[model samples]
Target chain A: MSNPESFRELCRKEIHTGPTSGVLPGYIQANLLILPKCVAESFEDLCTRNPVACPILSKTEGRPQFLRNHASLIKQGTFDIRTDFPRYNVYSRGKLVQQKNNCVNEWSSDHVGFLIGCSFTFEHALEKAGLVPKNVLYNKNVSMFRTTKFLDSAGIFHQCPYVVSMRPYKLTEVEIVREITRKFKKTHGEPLDWGYDGAKRLGI
Target chain B: MSNPESFRELCRKEIHTGPTSGVLPGYIQANLLILPKCVAESFEDLCTRNPVACPILSKTEGRPQFLRNHASLIKQGTFDIRTDFPRYNVYSRGKLVQQKNNCVNEWSSDHVGFLIGCSFTFEHALEKAGLVPKNVLYNKNVSMFRTTKFLDSAGIFHQCPYVVSMRPYKLTEVEIVREITRKFKKTHGEPLDWGYDGAKRLGI
Candidate 1:
């Protein structure tokens, strides 16, 4: 059996400090979103309203152990959610700035953790099906872009251009690609649009 | 906390003699196919080749533990491969005849168990995502039809039009339906084609 503790230890010591893509294999990986509890209910409502941007795998209130499904592997150390990730960008007034580990000390009890499904989960499923992922092989984060489309909004999470992660493949493999995409709704399942080129006006 | 043993007990007592559809929630229920050892390798090969059709969840040499993933559950009794399922049909010369349970005792030792992913997996996911499953609500088996598309074959599993199981929805819900379909690849991911009235072609 794959050891979850060792996996978490690798992350804790900064040993497995790379992007958590393709790490846990069949185990689900999730996106991290922390916000004050005042905004938590609103964000949860937002996710329910616009599931594409925020597919809630689990949510943590006051404590982080609520992510038991994914956090089951974090053996010895408590998940210092702020630092365990390879890198973190803090947003203040919607402006992102880099932050170091242990930012949890700054966290108040009013904070809530939203464990959203990430592309990593579906990407792993694709590789298991023998479909190669060019972005992962190239060792680059997926090509993410802010789109002109609007996502359903609730409270603080307002309607904005949907952000998308893209991967390119040959036309021959389109069937298999589409097949894999169909199974991962929580991870932004199917492409919003295919064969989109950079030169086309995005209308953003 | 669901019990796999309860399912075994039902099979043993002949109390639950029906398709094991939506029986156990949150557990991975599988499609069972047993083949002789001589043809097992080829069938396994076929499963790998056409993964969308035959996602081999767990293949046992001779009816190994079906609930290997659930260690905590109590195992009540042995699962008689020849009789455990609610119904059995025997194939001779590539033609299947409905048979009572245990008719295949003579062919038992020569058989190997192949558990493939079933649409039940994705149906669970869809229900979790709050998507309505029209077939379930209407009390019907999912609509299945033979497609003109050929699946990659192995040995006796010859090239034939893929048999796909489908559920329908209005045109307006297509995108949301596709999104839910993307998350469950083991369950035949997505539709190969849509809006084609397959039932009429099948003379159903």
Candidate 2:
């Protein structure tokens, strides 16, 4: 097992370049949101209204500092918002602007970063329950689909579609899966729906 | 009870100009954070790491749109972030820059806003449990103290002090207060500590 601190050091050194899935088994993983201050309020509203899709874990204060002693893995080190991530999907005016390894030059005094809880937190519980998450089994990213369900609008995020990441399981495993995932409230707790009908209900 | 939507309408029209404390009983009220995009990521990280002190309710989506049908009070209407609040405290480089009733001219697309949950959500529960929050009893804003406890740093927000809003309660009521407040996880959740020693432990 990689020492979480060492893993972070590698990320900081630009040596690790890949998805963070299953990297550090027990530690929590997060999705990231970086945006300008001008539209951050609306994004906050969206996360508030849509907790399932946007379970926020933490955010930075208005100034930059090295994160120290929040979670066990994020211990006593500074991470560059620009170059730390393996990849970043940049958005501009609600459109995918570009993909980059670092955004150091783009960062400024007015930017904000949000670390949202990803579905990975609960996958451990699912594995513990003896139900393997499909993505882990297949070595593929989880399937995500946009839904017809309208997310609550806040500021600039108006009536946007809710997105769902899917993992397949047998009919027999539904009960155990729900029961296990429900405990992870800070993550995307509980499945919204299941089966082929589930996709249809979401109007995928 | 006042119609929540109407109350918001007045605020939108610049007709209501006062603290929203106890305005709409039983409904949630939030503290507002509006900052330039340059520093928003750091602020977001701060909120995420220190949820107890800075429980975030929602954020803007980085665009301007009328918030429609999220919460009952925030029904179909456009809110001018720059002019809607009774007042706004402007911060520059982490310093209190200015306070304004309207920031219309200063607002730009590069700014983001955050609506953080205030302690009011649990106050009603406290009242119902026969333990009145001191702020409510005294008709004052809750007493807030800055603690020596350092908040977990995210991005640019490093080594910031944790700020806590205090509500004094009788020693006999500590258990009940903790029980009642614990249910409101989206807000500031349960009491961190109780009594004078609580402040001392927090290094006030």
- Which candidate's TM-score is highest? 2
- Candidate 1's C-alpha runs over 4 A off are A68-80, A197-204, B1-204
Name the TM-score of candidate 1.
0.47
| Each candidate's DockQ | 0.02, 0.02
The docking category that best describes candidate 2 is incorrect
Which lDDT tens digits does candidate 2 get at residues B1-204? 376656756766668766765667788878887777988876875676556667777777665433323434443354555666777777776688887776777778897878888887778767877787778887777788887555534445655766788887779877777667766667876666567765676667
Backbone clash pairs for candidate 1 read A182-B181, A182-B182, A183-B182, A183-B183, A183-B184, A184-B182, A184-B183
Cα distance off (Å), candidate 2, residue B68: 31
List residue ranges in candidate 2 displaced over 4 A: A66-76, B1-204
Candidate 1: CAPRI quality band? incorrect
Best by lDDT: 2
Score candidate 2 by lDDT.
Answer: 0.70
Q: Report the error of model 2 at residue A120, Å.
A: 1.3
lDDT of 2 at A38: 87
For candidate 1, write residues B1-204 as lDDT tens digits. Answer: 157666766775677776665667666667778777998876775665556667778666444444344323435355555556666677777798666654455456667777788886667666776776777666567777775444443445544556778777776765566666655556665544345443433223
